[model samples]
Target: MDMNAYLSMFIDESNDHLQSLNENLLRLESEPEELSIVQTIFRSAHTLKGMSATMGYEDLAALTHEMENVLDLVRNSKLKMDSFIFDTLFKGLDALETMVQDIVGGGTGKADVTAIVTSLQLILKSDYSAGKAAQPPLEAAVTTVDGSTSASGGMLLDEFQSSILLQSIEAGLHVYHVHVTIRNNCLLKAVRAYMVFEVLERNGEVIKSVPSVQDIEQEKFDFTFSVFTISGLTQEELQGQLLNISEIEAIVVTALDSETLAVLSNAPAAAAAEAVEATVESSAVKPKAEIAREAAPRKGQAAPAPANVSRTIRVDIERLDMLMNLFSELLIDRVRLEQLSSEIKRSDLTETVEHMTRVSSDLQSIVLKLRMVPVDSVFNRFPRMIRDLAKSLDKKIELVITGADTELDRTVIDEIGDPLVHLLRNSVDHGIETVEERIAAGKPETGTIYLRAYHSGNHVFIEVEEDGRGIHHERVLKTAIKNGVVTEEQAKQLSPDEINMLIFAAGFSTADKISDISGRGVGLDVVKSKITSLGGNVTIDSAFGRGTKFSVQLPLTLSIISAMLIKLGSEKYAIPLSSIVETGILRKEQIINVHGNRMIEFRNGIIPLISLSKVLDSPDFNENDEDETEIVVVRKGEKWAAVMVDEFIGQSEIVLKSLGKYLTNIETISGATILGDGYVALIVDPNSLIK
Candidate 1:
């Protein structure tokens, strides 16, 4: 069968299961006696093994299989679980994840898991005696069922009895028979047949085959076969089903004698009831295990019963982009309709328009929500990362995550993970001190790093904080001066916040010694650039002896944004509402020039001013002496800047469209949007404008 279709699902599910295993394994290390955790690990491993096997990735399958054996022993309480074991298991899971990722990336999914496999084997070997002892009784019970004396008599019933057996089978009742055939090459046929009879179950359950189902699977039965089935299918169908199986040449069906009938009837009832109860118990005992095993590969394990089945369909980003663009057009039309409704003032028509407005608004919301995803999707891998970092640094650190469930646009989520990883590594390698240093500094033995996210207004904020040595402002300033990122005079006039922002200066690192984690060269400048590329801002706050925090604020969605539309010259431009502090009209005389730069006195403070036309490289025009310029004040960090515009066009939400890949180096214009008049207006990038 072509397995490509299942590969995507297998990879997705395998990653999810592996992530769960990683997290739960950490918890298990702390609470080793938690059987539920062990069972969960077992289930994930088992599922991964089955998926790998089905995908024909034998290396992955073999690794997960070995991991499953170890987890099974842990679940059954035969092996002691501890931190060492948990760490080893986590490592194995990580390897398994890597292998799956390899397959997802179109590789062979092969990796050297020899070390992990050996470690697990050693764990099993350490408790081999106990495991062997416990397994023997179950093995013996199964063996007796395949080797017994009375199985031959049950198998030898004649054609007339076989016909009656077929009649009973067609009535939807279970038939039980024992089939015993000596192995084709066996020297003692009689003894082998008797051995098979010894284990014949007296239960009314169809032995189905004289040698038993287990024997059939093992291919232990020879030329002849016996079976009792209560299937509603005709004897010909039953015979054909058996005949279709490989390596089986001859077959016979038999009926029960009077005593055997009594035994069969009573035995099947009790056994059937017991089987039902056991199944329920097994399901309850290890629900995850059962799901994992059923989800594993077998010829006929029954298709998963569909109940409230939700499915995920992979959509191309381009499709969503196109959908967003089309919705933007509809939004513009809706705005036009509202304007037309107001102008005409027809009551009935206005009412219909109002209803359409509400419906369109709801549709817009649904489309936007479809693009919203939890921040946790990006945050999930960080804990494992922090764990590894702390261990390598010889530091005791606790990572605290809050508001991981906070939602953001898919575009932002996709771009945020790498910057967050860089920030976290910075915290571990530079922000947090070693365990001994922390203790000596009157701090707790373990350093604490906090990752928090929350939504406020139309923006979402994510913060990474470390309770370690805070950034030194003077050190940052000195570094900025040395790197020519800031003039000495500029450094002197900088506030503490401004000085701290200097860390984002390219090639700036305060670390005295270079190391793999952070100090070698690249700094927070890259982080800021990445966040700004997604229409977000990054800020740093620190207190000298306490700690440091890096906060990133991003718009809820990138495609469509609430913007303050303003006209500059003959062209309308959009300033994202999230970045606007306030807008007001300013007289030309109120604008002052301080040190050759235009400044406006607003809210009792002098704010720097920039001309929108000049920033956008538009044609210069003579100032209208009698007209008051519209001053839109924007804030980045704690500093305020104002841009003079031709007129205030009012605020409205608009969809942002990219200028396409070919239009490179378009400074200050982040994107373009369609207006109600069906004209494209540029959306300004305030960061680029101010810089």
Candidate 2:
């Protein structure tokens, strides 16, 4: 059989399982007594093992199998959890992730995990330490029932699985317990089982399976198996789907009530392990569809089925990008149509154009949402990273994350990982003090680092702050002066924030010497450059001996957005509505000069005034000497700017188009947009213009 067809799916699922293991293992480390956590880790590993084996990655499968054995022992109370065992399992997980990554990079998922395998073996063989012999206090009863687990392949649901079923029931979904028996003399039992799964999977998500998926694939079961599934299909419909897969078998589907599910969920370990054995007496055969109707509710009535199985599916990001591009072209034409309709003042044309505008607005929202993903996907990896780094540095630090559920563009999420990693590693290496130093400083033994993300208007802000030995101002200034990043006179004139930002300059380092981790004058500069290239800005704030914060302001890029189109001395430009506070007329006399910079006062705050024409070097800017100048007030975080323009063109939806590589590095202009008259207008990046 061809395995190539399944390779991509295998890789995606393997990565998912690996991430699950990492997350659950970290939880287990914190709560070793929580066997429930161990159960989750075990199930993820078990699933990965089956997938890897099916993909012919014996090394990955074998490693997972051994790790599963250890987890089984720990979860069952036959062995105890310890730092040693946790470290070994972590090693196994690391190896598994590496192998999966290799597969993603177009290599066989093979690795020399012999050392990991040996460590797992040793852990399994070693006797439980005397002090750690007993199971967790709450799990004592569960551990006692472990040895009496039934051999019959039964659908045993844990708390996690039970909650899913209960939630499905609440949502008006059907939870079915299906018992399927194969023929006594049936050949290729595995293939038949696969067919049955394919049917059920098409109808619903199988929450739990008897004989375990791996055992069924290995044909370790006698004949019959059971499954617990959640679906929007009625018993008749679901049974029909399953019965289409041919095999000599008897099947029964029981719709479970919440009461019965609760009883089974709280059942003792023994009853929960109830099994289904394959045996043949004698019975007349019937049509598959007939057997299906027999699965109808015994109560003579049924609740409504769910709408359908989930309407969601994984879509490649490239597909979304293509969709956005196509929508951009459609949007341009839509604007053109609206403009023509307005010109002609015809009812039919205007009405049709109005309808198109409404429909396209809804479509535009959906297309933009498709590219937004939760930052949690990126934040989830940091705990494990911090654990390893803290252990290596022999320091005690805790990572506190907030607003992880905040969403950002997938493009930003993909590129932001490495820069965040650099910032985090720097915090651990340079920002946080040693244990002894922390103790002597009248602070807790462990330091705290806050990694947070939040949305404000059109931008998402990410702040990495550490409460430890802050950036040394005198030292950084000396380093900046020595490195030629700033003159000695320039250093004297810099503000505290400006001096803090000096760390992001190319080839600037304050470290007395180079270290393996950070302080090589490399990471921060790269971070600044990468973020800037993404139409974002990074700023640092610090105080002596207190803490430091690096705040990154990022854009929410999409094809279509509402903008205030303006004329810049005969040339048109666009300003995103999200960034604009208000537009008004500012007389030339209202502007003030402060240190050779034009400034204006609005809402009791003084902010800089920037001339759009002067910034863009427009030839027509100086030709007119109007007494009053039109200005748009825009803000980036707390900093505000009044951008001068020639005229306001009112608000309209514009399609954002990127400036290709040849026009890259045009700092003030972030992107281009198409106007109703079919002319291209540069979108001014107000965040870049301010300071």
Candidate 3:
């Protein structure tokens, strides 16, 4: 069968199953006695194993098979899920995921899984209920479904195979058992079967065959053929050469010893019986794709059924992005028509333009909605991460999430993950306390970490809060002073909030020791910088002994915004309406220079005054020349800045376009927008302008 067509579907569905395995494993670990969770995990692993085998990724199948064995015992109540067992299973899962990733990266999905395999085999052999440890078995085999041991190391060897091993041993060559599986779509099965023999012959000598060499040459047997041979070549070199054959799907090359040869030749039927079942089962089972489809969501599994049977057609994201770009162009033309219609004072043109505006507004909503994805897609992976981290640190911490359903633009969603990870790790490593420390502080033994998101107007706010030891302001100040981030005298005037903010300073760390989790002064700075680059801001709030909360505020969408346009000298600028507090005329006399920077008193508080021309370095711009300037007040978190402009160009919806890649580092400008008259206006990033 051709596998290329199904490759994408395989990758996508495999990722889904891997996610299911991780989620179910975490659940099973939490509820060790829950047999149903074990069943769910088993089904996923079984399906994965089958799919991998079908796809010819033998290493992936083998690891998943070992995982299935452990899960099988758990579900049957034959083995317990202790911490050791859970750790081993999780390690297996990690190895499986890595192999899948290797396949995705165009590799053969093969990995050295000996260590993990040995661990799982130990689990299978151990007497878990009574807490007995597993010992090395002189002769070992996997227990099959019918409660029988299959001949693994030549126990099922035939007379011809045994004779060959003996001859090879006498010739001073190593004996090996090799199982060769032919590729599904090969030139000829019989010819390729001989090709396997050919490769072995070139390397050393093929002594005997399982189904007899005549049956193999005539293609009388199933797709797989086994052989016992003598080889002077090292196992690695021989295996690599065997894989070089085009029609070869899998190869299991095992070096055999004299003890195994003596034991296996005594019970050929029982040993051969083990190999017979796999062939018959493989032939009898439904096609690979069909089997994969029906094998998951077994009884007692929690798979939500939709209310209605709905049909969905997959559309490429590139197409959606193309549609959005075309609509943006249409929007620009419509704005130009609106401007022309208003200036011409024609009722027919005005009415037509107004109707078009209404229609396009609806289209805009749909396009933006199409680009909006729930933040939960990113939040879903965190629980499993937290679980593992908590176990590794030996800390009792609960990750409580809320408002995961809040939607954000996909572009913002993509960039937010790493920053959130940094912040969450900080919470886990620093914000949360150990069990003993929590007890000493008279708090609950288990620390609680809150992850939350919600939309407020045009922005989404995500908060990571922990109910453990909060930021120690004095310690932070001390570190800041030592790191030269602040002078000792400078630290004296800093408020608690200001002191907390110092944690985000570059290369800031108050940790006395370093661990894999954190304590290298790297996380918070990365979190802050990434959030800021996403046209967002992150703030820190702590209550000393109580807890700490890191709040991330991001724009709901990076592209397109309703802004108040302003004129600065001959150039026009835009300020996102989401950041605007109010627009007013500030008399030049009202702007008083306090310690060099111009400051203005508004209502009850004083705010720094920023001149647009001065910031942009406009030619012939004199801050002292204007009598009364139009001032637009913008905010960043709790801080505010009054920006002076020459005139206000009224409000309009504008598409935020990227300023060519070269202009990315422009501090005060987030992006550029096309005006109705075809002039480009710089959109001011208030968050960046605010000192």
lDDT (Cα, tens digit) per residue for candidate 1, span 612-642: 7766766744345446777788875566788
Residue 467 miss distance in model 2 (angstroms): 1.8
List candidate 1 segments past 4 Å from native.
127-308, 346-352, 477-493, 520-523, 561-653, 657-674, 677-691
lDDT of 1: 0.69
Ten contiguous residues with the weakest lDDT in model 1: 137-146
Using TM-score as the measure, the top candidate is 2
Clashes of 3: 1
Candidate 3: residue 52 lDDT (0-100): 75
TM-score for predicted model 2 compared with the true structure: 0.77
Q: What is the lDDT of residue 175 in candidate 1?
A: 56
Task: Order the candidate numbers by lDDT, best to worst.
Answer: 2, 3, 1
Best by lDDT: 2
Model 3 regions lying over 4 Å from their true place: 129-322, 345-355, 562-651, 658-672, 677-691
* Model 3, span 206-303: residue lDDT tens: 55566655455445666777777778777655665676567677666777666666765775455545544454344433333343355447889986
State TM-scores per candidate.
Answer: 0.65, 0.77, 0.63
